[model samples]
Target: MSKLGENLLKISVILMVLLSLFLSWKIWTKPANHQFQDRTDKVKAVIQKKEMTEVYMPTKLFYHHGSGDHFLYTNKESTMKSLHEKIVSLGFGSSKVLSTAEITNLTTKRDLFNLVYPSPIPISLFINMNNVSATLPHDSKNFLFNWLVMSLDDNKLYFVDYKNKTGIEFDIKGNIASIASILDAESNNYVTAILPTDELNYAGIYYLADSTKLKTYSYIIATQSFTTFSRGFFNQPNDLFSNEGENLSLSNSEGESLTIDSKTGEVNYFGKLKQDHSESINELYYETFQYVEDMGSSLGNLRYFSDTGNEVIYRNYVEGFPVFGDNMKGSMAATVQNKNVFIKANQDTLQIPLPSDDSVTLVPTQEVVDSLINKGVDMSKVSDIQIGYKWQQNKETQQAIDLVPSWYVNYDNMWMTQEKLESILVKGGHS
Candidate 1:
């Protein structure tokens, strides 16, 4: 063959070979339906091996333990047990089982992931580790460990850093007022807390790589007024409690209080109080005027008998009682004396007198009257009155009455009823 013909023939053969190679590469790398199915199967195998019976396919796992109860995902007993084991394996120490309610009490939006174990201490200690999944500016290797030290009932989220021995609390915004290091991130210390800006009027969870530095995350829905009768605090946008009219309550380590709202679950008002006050204070204060529903029905005759019973029945109506503090047995009292309502705290017999036709006047000691005057409390304008006190222990029956005063005002004409009077008495001295 001629030289030119030979060269052309070689070039044609090489072109054909290149075309075949390109087609083969595309066929080999393309993903198929079967391949996708195989990947799903692998994931299922791992889940099965872990014995996770209640699997939320698309949901991220949430775990917590508190007040002798353990919770994971939802309030399922089986899932709680599995989570307990997983936490133990992850280096948690001896733990006592806690109820789902208790676990929820320990968690906040910033918590991301947590593992709490029941303890005798007034506050429960749990490993509050930053959830890499929930965090922004994501780093694959950075790990943060924080000790969430909080009272079983207090709304304060205290972040304790054992390594650095320093902490800050994020009140209400991220469960507590402080965020310390429970785990280290990037060999440097990281802290978490809630930061509130007056411009926003809402609090956001912040992560700090070091002192004086911060990275803010999503805004947290503070517990608003009128939604204080439920069992949980700080519901997420996606949480079931986020729905309107979800029974909710506000609480601190010291106590819990109830209120009702017909509006949405988002905390609308920042609460009419100072920033230093605990978040639960608003609920506790509001509860003083609120009546507990079905207390007599739920506890039957036992509701009015025991000291704890009375407190429990009236807790939703009192502001001073700790939501999660020691359950002290006591009696509450309220009365309208003269034009002013007088509330006194003592362990004594409680007697609430009926409304009288004659004008009643509360005669506080001159010292107390002076104090009220200093604080700008207008005694002359105060016509409606309430009183509450703790009953004293009696040696005869081995019983004592601890009275707590709570009262409220009637929306109509502002006629002071005994119920409102009692709540006011408690609210006056407690807040």
Candidate 2:
């Protein structure tokens, strides 16, 4: 070959080798967090487009941890109008049985849609008591109400028993907050103590009525603790995210005295309300999930856990699992006086991918019960047993958190964690 041709050939070979090395380096050194970039982008797109995330209401054999055995039944045409009709017909107090075919079709549609669509759909399942599945283990004697409302928002699935004639409601964060509207007039005025619960957290305010005494009650159930406030008063209309998306400001009618960090949605109001409580703690919990005004992020589901004196505590649930934080964290508390509702939430969300269901093996209910009984727990006294995820601080990486599967036993006044519940099964022992 000619010398000029040889030179060109050698240069081309060198360029190809350099390009290949660069590509390899880029692939090998890619950040671990960016692995799910495509999925994250799609989620962002869906949010920006305001796409109606399909909400599935199943009507068939359903088996999950939260709700025992319940299914939604409808004989009307398959349309959104029909769905609304079903909800309205069940208004106040109503009960009726549905046929097997209706349930089968509903169940089929749900399964088929989920299988075809990669994106997740928020689902709420309603189960009637009279027609619960025969194969499912049930405690009819232990039943608290006639209907069960099971809701799935993002990763968390919450189940609560509802009495006949009660309407269902979802908070701003897409959690079941139907019970929040119920007013315990006695507790609202004079509540000194509140125990923890497996449900979402809550908070509110009350007038002690000792020469116009006011108290702000806050509780964090995951850690089983409460925060209180003495007599103090702030001016009316302490607006927080009122005008579309505005940060909260506190003042005594002069000007802005204290401006809360809107991102965290923090508030320190221990005063009386100028207006009535338009929204309960449950409503505030839902609103926080949608927009935090100055806070540039949304939160996961915050389910109602418990309430004490005019206050309620709700916990954050991500990907259908409960998140655990220190006493100062883990849950959101609210204080309501007259109609003024003050919420204290310090939780935030990250757009990270959730661990696959296959990665976490759920502990069976029976096994959990057995473990509790072996641990000397009185089954009769045990209120609720739920399988959920708890966030544990990753000691190896500061500021990083790990979601660990946990068995939470709600007994007496607090939530008990039996980390060793899985160990018994691993050791091949079941009495």
Candidate 3:
């Protein structure tokens, strides 16, 4: 009886050990196959989802550079190569300074361009109301030409075509026509031909219409009505007066004086000014924001662009997107010094309405980069690639401006739009 019992117990113990080993092996192998299948399914789903929702708005604003029209890059690599070649052709050999057309191209959306390159002002405004449309390097040989004329009687400005003798009146108020170079204040007659430089600052100039010779004069007047002074020298407003049609001079008995634009009201103060406080760059940035807030203007965030000895530049963001004006100098600007700060903010005048839906599905950043590379963007030459918003006017009106998502590539000392780059790449069969 003892031998039979021992044999049976030994067999049962062996059987139990074998069963446990089998179960362990099965558990490990089964889950491995299942996990692999699960990961593969996820990868496929992501690919399909991206394909389904890839369409985006192509509303980015495009501009022309010198010898180039308000052009879009139809071929990526060639277009970029073209711009790069133009820059290299200048023979500066790595000089960062661009041409007037190139700088105009870079600063066309100065508010956003400052994001790509850097500037001294902290915030820029999207100014479309004052912008006039004309081809770059205004060709004198063109049959049709444009000129700006001021009617003293109505205190109005107009864009006139000499060929057609037609003029579209401007809605500018105030008696500012005298600020132009060619104005007859008594007779209410002033007119000037548009120049390339005028396109930069949108300043006032006067031109006389003489068949034999075209005479021109320029004017800039900056004004200030101060409420706060860093120094305790309280002065009366009587100190300020128009020394000429284009100049408004403000002088204090202390020998300090300021000159301002009579028409645009732009002011530049010279001489010793007192300072109550000196702010760091970050502090100045916050101060600029507070200045905008105090004016009860629209809500927009500031992204620092650049700074110099006297001024700092920042780009304005609304709903977390950058606003683009005609050039990158920005629409909003401030002059902060040791003792006094002067801010000229244009947001109060812009009429940008948010999109019905603020959300957008952007193309993946990597894919965008790949597209750019294919279009001929030398990654080595690109200082940076950034995502921001560029504002575009509809029907040349600021009231119907659209803030669009955009990709900016800073290369060859210029800021170019992704739409221009993509078009070139896609046309090259890279899309």
Candidate 4:
């Protein structure tokens, strides 16, 4: 071979060697947070899959006597689930959009009791939750309602899609007398709470008419094994590997990964997911439910909070109020990306309730709002306000958590502690 040709061949070989070395270094130094290395065994924990009816039940229950103030089911454990099941079982005859005149009267009229969800949900899902899987029309599958209203004097039922200021009417299909009795009996269980159906003209927010005290609770927590996540998410758990770090990260060659925080027991998982672009709203919910069911663990009464088009969030509800925090104490979320699914779940969850005497006295809703405004929070910017439990984890141990009663407000679409919102808006507040 010519000398010049030999020189060119050597240069090509050197270039090839350099490319290989660069690739090796990139893989070697990949951040430990998501480094791809070892195999994990299948870890199984028995957490029963919840029925659609249980998780998707209403979050709020209120009764209106028409002439006077309304009453709220103040018992911390929500009575809405039992109510929802009864209503769903009773069935419906027809649905129609509420007339403009009727929609206008929703706030002023006090003759109805309603079950409210945290956000809008399709009517078909409501029906399916009853365990009656019937094919529904496109309208029912897509029509969403924030609350289901039932007439106390009359047996008429309505599903209000608050966003559209429209609603569908349904004839109560079952025994009207039985339904009436149930609502009537609730009078004994409800606390006299004032809903600003007069001035603010909204029925969503409920204010305890008098000073009432709620108890705080501590719970012994239990976390699912890291391997449970790996086995549930990845098709091949044997291919995933983990290291001894503060966070348990399991990865494989197939591009699926799981990261679990050792302290908080929060989990972040990314996996190859195939979703049908044309799937109906009902299908989306069903599939997500299956995914949650597949991943077994100790989930404390997780209830569907909302679906924000981008993601679906389920929160932990205790004694009728939801527990909230950045950590996934009683929460799990599912999001679908292009050809992939990302899930955020918590391994650590509140389990056994510990005996506690801690209790907090919360003022009336009007007072809570007034105080917030006095503290410089712009009430107009506040879209939502309610009471819920704030999860406070014990710093000393990972196995304990405290649920503290606190006020939460949706400020400019962001939900935060009333105190946090106060701090943010204290200086002239946000417009």
Alpha-carbon RMSD to native, per candidate: 29.9, 20.2, 30.4, 15.8
Model 1, 1-431: lDDT tens digits are 66677547545544554565466446434432221111332332332121111111111123232332222222123333343333223322222333344433333433344322110111111221111122112231122223344332334333333222333333332312222222212222222222222222111112111223111111111121221212112111111112223433232322222223323222211121111213332222122212212111111111111111112122211221111101222222122222121111111112221111222232222333344445544444432222222222222222112222222222222323344334555577321
1-431: candidate 2 lDDT, tens digit per residue: 66677557545544554565466446434443221112332333433311111111221112112232222211111332232223323323222233344322222222111111111111211222122222211222222221223223322112222112222222223222322221111222321211122122111001111121211111211110011111012232222121222543334332313333444424444433433424432333233222222122233344445455666555654433455554324455656655554656543232233222224454445555556666655554444555445655544322234566566655554565655433543576432
lDDT of 4 by residue, 1-431 (tens): 66677557545544554565466446444555444322443134344556666677777777776466556554434355556666767766655667867875765566677787887888877765666434443456677888788875556688886545677776666666665566667344677776564434233466778766889987766556565666566665664556557676787778877887866668998886634533565765765665566564356677788776668888888888888977766788888756567888887677667555669998777887887867866555665677889989755344467899998887777778888887776665564
Candidate-wise lDDT, in order: 0.25, 0.33, 0.34, 0.68
Q: In lDDT terms, how accurate is model 1? A: 0.25
User: Model 1: residues >4 Å from true position, as ranges?
Assistant: 1-25, 28-194, 197-203, 207-431
Q: How far is 340's C-alpha from truth in model 3 (Å)?
A: 8.4
Give each model a TM-score. 0.15, 0.39, 0.33, 0.81
Model 4 residue 336 distance off true place after TM-score fit, in angstroms: 1.1
Alpha-carbon error at 107 in model 2, in Å?
19
* Candidate 3 residue-wise lDDT, 293-340, digit = tens: 332222233444444455554555443334554433224455666556
Collision count of model 2: 35
Model 2 misses residue 404 by how many Å? 1.1
Descending-lDDT candidate ranking: 4, 3, 2, 1
Model 2, global lDDT: 0.33
Model 4 residue 47 lDDT? Answer: 41
Clashing pairs in 4: 38-240, 38-241, 39-240, 66-110, 76-319, 77-319, 96-169
How many clashes (backbone N, Cα, C below 3 Å) per candidate?
70, 35, 36, 7
